[model samples]
Target: MSLKRRSFLKGAAGGGAALATAAVVSAPAQARPNKVMPPQAVGLLYDSTLCVGCKACVAGCKEANDLPVDVSTPDALWDTPLDIGPKTFNVIKVYAEGTADTKDQEKNGFAFIKKSCMHCVDPSCVSVCPVTAMTKHPQTGIVEYNADACIGCRYCVASCPFGVPQSEFDTPTPKIMKCEMCKHRQAEGKIPMCAEVCPTGATIFGPIPALTEEINRRKAMKAGEANVFERRVIGSGDTHERPAAKYLDHVYGEKEVAGTQFRHMSAVSFTKLGYPELREQSYSSQSEGIQHSLYQGMIAPVVVLGGLVWAAKRASHIEDEHPEE
Candidate 1:
């Protein structure tokens, strides 16, 4: 081969080799495991059977977060949102069957389900965010959004399996909005507004351990049996008496997506309550594995770039030797 031609070929070979090496090195790293929830994580336990669809939690959320009204309909003068949006951080969605005669019954009944962030143990929003806009607290396990750090990218919105994070499209300076589990209130020795205002203990906030225990207790309860559930927060010394509805054998968010800080329980199947059926493993685990494998230490790109530079330099040297043939 001619010297110039050889130089070009050498460069191409080097670049290809570098890329191949990078792929080989990254493959195993991409198989890395997903993250687990923090030991002291705090979150909400939403019992659909206990909910009365009063929307007190919705109003409290708006008031606590200082969020504006979401007028869903043109003629509607109230802040009645159809779902969780920028203006409506927490919403009560209804699932009605034929007749809608009874509450919590799947057939011929209507049921209420709360919609908000799941606050995933391994959050896809936090994983996908290019900027540090979405973050999870180590102690509380609350997924939070920082508007100042956000670049208005809807990566979080697209990544969330629960469809929690919502971007503000109406305003000029748009921000992604979602529930933070009232961490601000907790900082001030108060509970989340949604939990605080929940009269039926539908939405209870507490440490994950305690909540898990409560979930187990409730799950074991006989249907139609009277049970006393703690209201607002666990260990808050507040209790309420009510008859337990027949609970589905599963708990939403318990193991789904490696689990979520916010757990859910219901009489009807979670699918009927508008929950997306998700695998126990997290998507972040797979995505991050690929990402880390390829760019763990920025080694792959640097190696590839270095190989390209070396090739170009060799090609230039060959041209200089040939004197511009």
Candidate 2:
């Protein structure tokens, strides 16, 4: 019998073919671009299996950005937010199932996922900014927003495919909030704070090339195998050895948004922590290409505007010549 996607009843996974054969025919991971960044601009690769869900990265991000806490309970002293929002640029959210003991397994496994600005390869926020308020740095590809140039239109908030930017709704003079990859600290030769303070080495900072190698090493191992996980940045000597959680054979942001600067690997199905089932081609990149092709140098629009002005003037002159008619 044919089975639906969410069910394990009868179709794809349960088809009567050899398991090896079916795996070979299953879809391949999306291809990413060879677009280059500067020598020093840094990013992170997070393995969900390595994370202990300690919330240290979230706290570190808040401290690094000098941002205030988004409190869920006014009566509580420790300001823990349930999700990313205007006051919180990063958050560690949890997903649970029955018993929730296994790390990456789908049936009853629980896992932690870190959420923040994806820093998209082709950012929708950058494309839709009317005044260049949201911009991609040439070297780092970090999307930064300037509030001075924004008209509070929330174009960026709406256009971002990852829904990263959030407006401060409670304040009178509100501003959109999001991660800028800690560029200010990066200028001082510091890595991103979350990566800096991650104790488990679940989050490591470096170029995409090096990060991919690290991820490959993990994928090569069998479940329950011992591996030394690096915390913070690679080559930093901060590491710990632990038995590997069963990886889900998927990397979250490796190809999402045409490859996010910050990549993710996890043991659990991403949907557990709210990752959307995705299209490989980035909507932001597609949207920008279409817009640029149509409006190159504004030459076409100028010619259309000139024709419109000439028609309006001619109509006015004809009306003056025969006022009565």
Candidate 3:
């Protein structure tokens, strides 16, 4: 073969080999295990069965957080929020089907679901933050955001799986907003306003272990049997007696991304109450693996292109030197 022909063939072969190995080269790395919860982690136990669709918790959260009222209607008379927004940090959404007469019944009933941050053990927001603005407390496991450190990038809002973080759009200067489980109250030795004002004790706060125990106790009670539930926080003297609703075996936060501080239990399906179906694996692990693979393979294409360009240039130079008969 002529020198030019040999060079072109060699370059083509090299390019072909690079293309063939592209998939293997770009394959993501193995995913790591999800993170575990902190020992002294504090969170809330929200029982959907016990909720009465009252806006007391919602009102209390707004007051405690010093958030402005969300005027959903044109008149703007009352503080009516359709969902958690920049103006509203927490909300109670209702799931109704058929007649909706009975509470916590799927066939022909309704249920109330509390909307707020889950405070995930392996939070995506904390992982994706460019600055250390979004942080998960090591001891308490509470996720907090510092607007001063934030550049209003909105990466936290996009990374969150539960759609908890929200950016204010109405004002010129916007900040990300989410529920921090009333951590400010904790400093003052007070519980979350939402939990304190919960008339049915639907929302209770305390250490995760104690809350888990309370959840187990409620699950053990037979359906339609009376059980006394503690109010505000676990070990709180305030209590209320009510018939236990049939609960699902699965706990919402328990095994989801290696668990979350805020846990939930419900007689109705979580999907029916607007909660998304999620796998136990953390999304960060999967994303990081993909990122690593891409980083490794980024130079492959450049090398292949360089070889092709060099071969073309050499062929052109030889053609000019040796004129065709």
Once model 3 is optimally superposed onto the true structure by TM-score, how far is the C-alpha of residue 13 displaced, in angstroms?
Answer: 12
Query: Candidate 2, clashing residue pairs?
Result: 104-267, 201-230, 201-231
TM-score of each candidate?
0.87, 0.78, 0.85
Q: Per-residue lDDT of 1-325 in model 3, one digit per residue for the tens? A: 2556655676667666656565465554677667788889999999999998788999999999998889889999999999997888889999999999998899889998998899999899988888989999999999999989999989989988889999999888999999988899988999989899998899999999999899889889999999898899999889989999999998899888768888889988999988888899988767766666566656655655665666566665666677661
How much does candidate 2 score in TM-score?
0.78
The true-versus-predicted C-alpha distance at residue 241 of model 1, in Å, is: 1.6
Candidate 2 residue lDDT tens string, 147-184? 89888888888987677999999998888899988888
- Residues 253-275 of candidate 1 have per-residue lDDT tens digits of 99899999888899888988889
Displacement of residue 292 (Cα, Å) in model 2 is 3.2
Best by lDDT: 1
Off by over 4 Å in 3: 1-28, 292-325
**CA lDDT, candidate 3, residue 91:** 92
Worst 10 residues of 1 by lDDT: 23-32
In angstroms, the error of model 3 at 36 is 0.6
